[model samples]
Target: MYLEKLSLTNFKNYEDGRYVFGRQINVIVGPNGSGKTNLLDAVYFLALSKSAFQNQDAFSILHGADYFIIDGIFEENEHSGHPNRVNPDRVQITISLQRGQRKVIMADKKPYERISEHIGRFPVVLIAPNDTDLVREHSEDRRHFFDGVLSQLDPNYLRDFLMYQQVLKQRNSLLKLFAERNQVDNDMLDTYDVPLLDLGQKIHDRRKQFVEEFLPGFREHYAYLSNESEMVNIVYESEVSDPNFAEEFRHFRRRDTILQRTTMGVHKDDYSFLIGGVYGEAVPLKKFGSQGQQKTFVIALKLAQFDTLEAEKGVKPILLLDDIFDKLDDRRISKLIQQMEEGAFGQLFITDARPERTRELLSSVKADVRFYETGV
Candidate 1:
């Protein structure tokens, strides 16, 4: 499936904007600070139900506007001859957010009971310049990235993840209340602990399995990007891996009470990126890898994400490349362009600051390319 049309109302700098996109490669070119990234983010928001850059939905609304709306029309290829088709060939998805209110997502004018239901319906993968932060930043970044992929690929995982977050929040609140009242309600805390442990274990197991299944593609892509110069590995670490995690969790109750939060769980898990050292031992990529190697590592991770989603969903997702031309060197850019020439991607969107340079770089690509010049 591909996004055929996109309409933005009071989104970021766009007061009212609409675009008809090509099914292949569509390049958005404009000067810096001209809403080029914001335009691409509108598509990302429509597909994923939130802004890629901003954590708050309200920040996406145009200045002086009370709300923002992002609407898109996605069309399936005519030759996709899969049975058991319940929806139509085309679907309209609309996401709107009003200040201080819950975001709403509707498909074909029908609202879903829960936002989680809308996820994974139109999976998407985005490669951005800040992706290197996955390696250099804290463990929360890595956890969030992997968890997002898993959530999009598995509905059961998404359900359990959402429930786990809810229960954890309630549990933390209870801990705070106990500190305020100077009393520990062991029985009351047990109510939240039971499901939290169960869901945490389930999430941990799925994450371990995902890392194993995901490593092959990740390593293969890294090899292609790095030209087999070095080996790369991801180590999934979690406290839940302890044989007596349940007992340890119970033991941490006193500490959790003092801390006023749940400290040990899948939420605290981390994925370590390791690259082959000079002597063949794996070393931390964040500490030892060069800038080029770090870039390649994150790019490889995103490409692997694309491969896994396509394989799981049986449909190529919409790929968004945000200012990657500015971030990647010529060799890396050539590799991506070669992929475009080889028809390895479907319905791609790229943003560039220089229109002439974009044309020059993509000149050799044989696929259908349409350019949208912004800040005119």
Candidate 2:
């Protein structure tokens, strides 16, 4: 699949915009606050039905724009290694926001119900400047990022993921209510627990399997990036310390009553970063690594995520690099650009203000790179 064109209406910084995209490469370049990030956000919103930068739909709309819409024309390939089949003409999405109105998503100009169908079909892997937050911040963020990427590839995993999250939401809401009234909502408790245990267990199992298979590929990229054999840690921290989730549930029942919340299960699960934990290293990457090492490893993780998704889905995901070159120096930037030029990606979109910086790094590579100015 490929993006033929991108159309936007009343989106951030672009009241109306249309751009024909390169089948393999699209570069949006301009000075600071020139809608570079907003353009990337448009692509992301088209693919995921939400902004990659914000948690709220209102935040994605332009300050004064009443509504926003994005449209993309995708061409499908009917011929593959296997026998040929009919291809989808196109899949278009429209995201809208109006005052006192709820956001609605339409597919092919029609109301889209099962949005998940669009996920892996038009997959994407994004690397923003702030992605280092995966290492610098809490473990929960890392877990969510990796799991979300994996879920986008496997619908069964996604089912388990969403089920656990829904159960967690209902459970937390019940706990909040109980805390307010100082009474156990036993009905609410039962309502979420039965499915919670099942879904949580599946989620844990899927994560465990995903990490085990993904670590090698991720580590390979890390070594290639930093030339370090520190064996950067990729641990899958399970929510249930023991296999007996049922027993853990009972043990936490008393605490649940006291705190008015179910404390045990996948809801609280997190994956920690520690090299010495398993490899008996001098020190874990997170603890002793320099800024350079951390950034290299994070980029490696994103690449590995792309590989894992491609291997599982048999389709290379569209890559989005949000100012990834800003943090790295000349040498590192050159090496990374070399890899990217060697067909490390299929379709890519990158944003940055420094055209000279991008030029210096990619001087040897001939691509469909173009420079365009954007501003509010």
Candidate 3:
């Protein structure tokens, strides 16, 4: 599927805007502050039902504006062989959020009973300049990246994950109440603990299985991007993997109450990146790898995500590249360009500050190319 058109109102830095995109390569050219990234984000929001860069929906709203709307038309290819086709030709998805109100997502003018239902219907992969944050940032970042991928690939995983997060939040709130009153209520805590443990185990199992399935594509992409100079791997770590996890979870209740939070669960899981030269023992990529290696590692991760989503969804995902040309070196850029020329990806949206540089880089690609200039 490809995003054919996008319309934005009151979104970040976009008071009002509309764009018609090509099915192959569409380049968005503009200066740094010209809303180029905002346009790409509008597509991401429409596909995923949330902004990629913002934690809260309200943060995506334009300053001084109380609401924001992102609307898009996704077209399906007839040759895709997709089994699930609600609408044969095109689907219109609209998402709107108002200040202090719940965000709403609608497909073809009908609102979904739950926003989760809309996810994975149209999957997207984004490669941003900051994706290396997955390597340098906290464990939460790594978990979030993997969770997002699994969520889009399997709705059941998304459901369990959402339920797990809700339970975790409610349990933390209860712990805080217990701390405030200086009372321990084991019975009340059990109410939240039972379901939390069940969901945590399910999430942990699915995550572990996904990592195993995901590693092959990840390593393959890295080899291509880095010319097989080094080997890279991701290790999934979680306390929930322990056979005694249930007992330990119960044992931590007192400490959890004192701290006013859930101390241990699947919520604290992490994916550690390891890198090493051929025939050498791998070490932490964050500490030992060079800047170029770190960037290649993250890019490979994203490319792997794109491949996995396409394999599961039976349709190539819409690829979003935010300031991608500015971040990669010539060799890496050439590798990506080769993929573009070889039809390794589907619909692509790229942002670049310099129109001339974008033109020069993509000149060799033989496909329908459309260029949109922002801040004109």
- Candidate closest to the true structure, highest lDDT: 3
Which digits, one per residue and each the tens of the lDDT, describe model 2 over residues 1-376?
Answer: 6677788888877888888888676777888887898998888888777788888877777778777778887665643112253664555566677856977777678876766656666677888888878878886788779777876778788767877877787787777777778777566677778888888778878888888898889888887877665667677776565767677796676577677667787767776665433456545566777887778878888899889877866667788888877877766777678877898787888887887877776667667766555663
User: What does the lDDT come to for candidate 1?
Assistant: 0.92
For each candidate in the order shown, give its overall lDDT on alpha carbons.
0.92, 0.75, 0.93
Candidate 3 C-alpha lDDT tens digits along 1-376: 8898889999999999988889999999988999889888899999999889999899999999999999889887553445575565887899999999999899899999998888888889999999999999999999999999999989899999999999999999999999999998999999999999999999999999999999999999999999999889999999998999999999989999999999999999999999984688889999999999999999999999999999988889999999999999999999999999999999999999998999999999999999999998
TM-scores for every predicted model: 0.97, 0.91, 0.97
**Which scores higher on TM-score, 2 or 3?**
3
User: How much is the lDDT of residue 140 in candidate 3?
Assistant: 94
Q: Candidate 1's residue-wise lDDT over 1-376, tens digit each?
A: 9999999999999999999999999999988999999998998888778788998899999999999989989886443333456564887899988898898899899998999887887889999999999999999999999999998899899999999999999999999999889899999999999999999999999999999999999999888877899989999999999999999998889889899999999999999999995678899999999999999999999999999999988888899999999999998998888888888899999999987888999899998999998888
Question: What's the lDDT of the predicted structure labeled candidate 2?
Answer: 0.75
Error of 1 at 62 (Å): 0.9
What ranges in model 3 sit over 4 Å off? 77-87
What total of clashing residue pairs does each candidate reach? 0, 1, 0
RMSD (Å) of each candidate, 1 decimal: 1.7, 2.6, 1.5
**240 Cα displacement, candidate 3 (Å):** 0.9
